[model samples]
Target: MMPQSFETFNNIVNSSPVLTDRFSALVQDTISAAREQHGVDLTIEDCTAIAELRNATLGATLDRDELDRQMLELSSLSDSKLKADIAAGDQEAMAVALQKVNAGKEVVHYERSSDDRARRISMARELGIATPPPVQDDLRSRAEKIELLQEVKNPAQRVALARKWGLL
Candidate 1:
């Protein structure tokens, strides 16, 4: 079974405005499944926010019109009037080009989150891309390892366990 990351879950909500009550139930089920199967050690606060923000950024398509207006207002100025725009340096352009840059950043920030890497992985897998499995949850400690190894009597099993635990 594929794992759903918070990011992919957010995408599902954002992609559709008309979600059903069943979607909430599904999210809960996914949260349970991820916790059980994927070893995603999230704080309660993180889980709470993930449940809340599942739809929070849905309508967050940065106001491109406002950005364009800002740019147009800047462009309408005479080159001599705006010192920042005509400093004959790319840095100057960058300083004045904040409107588009900032809005584009908003789109990117909306599209992904550090907390959503799992969801992104899920999406990638859905697209038929190969994804590495989540790192295994190794619960064995040194003492536990020794205890486990003490029972290895068969030669083949010993070799297999040794290779698995890097004993050889």
Candidate 2:
């Protein structure tokens, strides 16, 4: 049985001609490459998974683009705010403005990191690399595992969980 969320996403993609066309092209390419390069006949499930990864990578690209635009806007605004704070000699306001700028930079950094990971995973899938199946553990629900994974800041730990989920 298809998960409800995936069914909904599929319906949304189907509704959009552009998205449907893109997915069809990606699926065909992946299928052909897998057959030729690995002598592997991909199942429908494998094709679907690869398409989903590609979609996610596309989303991350869009997100990064938007973040770049936002950062530019924020930089312009911050420059004006900093100048005003400096002219007014309000050290506290200047500090606050700088902090906000730093926060935005941090957000951009995080988003870029996420986008890099998505791109890597998508590329790996496209190349027909065999990903390990998710490990079976009694302690954590899928949602909990995902939540924990996101909270982890350590690169090694994050990679471990990503691999466990066949995302690396």
Candidate 3:
């Protein structure tokens, strides 16, 4: 159950156009479901709780366009810094360049993962599922794979494992 008061819920919903739209679309259905399944007419508070649950269960709403815009800006900034560092032609600059490259890769990977999660959540909602899809496999991040590679004494075996994981 939502612990928030009706006024708090109203404030929240009013602050976000997305939430307002979602609440508007969901309220009637929520009320009907409560009446049919629970044999109780929902109060305004009850309806808000149901809407909040549905929203929360799916995941936070993301503005993909805004996220993409920010990512592009960050990538541009990183690339400029990396190029300048490489152009300096010093050992420290070279190390900084490598770090920048790794950081950029990490950011891109994170963005892609967030996109995948949002896609899965959207798909689940479309299929009328009440819960987000279960993760089916344990996947290691690139950094974890790199750390694991350091433990492998055989260089050839390390390369093979890296290739298998698409880290090469």
Q: Highest TM-score: give the candidate number.
A: 2
Clashing pairs in 3: none
Runs in model 1 lying further than 4 Å from the true structure: 1-137
Task: Give per-residue lDDT, candidate 2, residue 139.
Answer: 82
Worst 10 residues of 1 by lDDT: 71-80
Candidates 2 and 3 compared by TM-score, better number = 2
RMSD of 1: 22.1
Candidate 1 TM-score versus the reference:
0.19
Taking the tens digit of each residue's C-alpha lDDT, what string does model 1 give over 1-168? 223565566456556655434445434554464456443333323432432333333433334344323323322222222333433444555444433223334344655765355554453344223333333438877678767878989879877776666556
TM-score of 2: 0.31
Give residue 34's lDDT in candidate 1 (0 to 100): 44
Give the clash total for candidate 2: 0
Model 2, position 69, has a per-residue lDDT of 36
- Scanning candidate 3 in windows of ten residues, the lowest lDDT window is 67-76
Where does the lowest 10-residue lDDT sum fall in candidate 2? Answer: 67-76
**Model 2: residues >4 Å from true position, as ranges?**
51-168
C-alpha root-mean-square deviation, each candidate: 22.1, 22.3, 19.2
User: Which residue pairs in candidate 2 collide?
Assistant: none
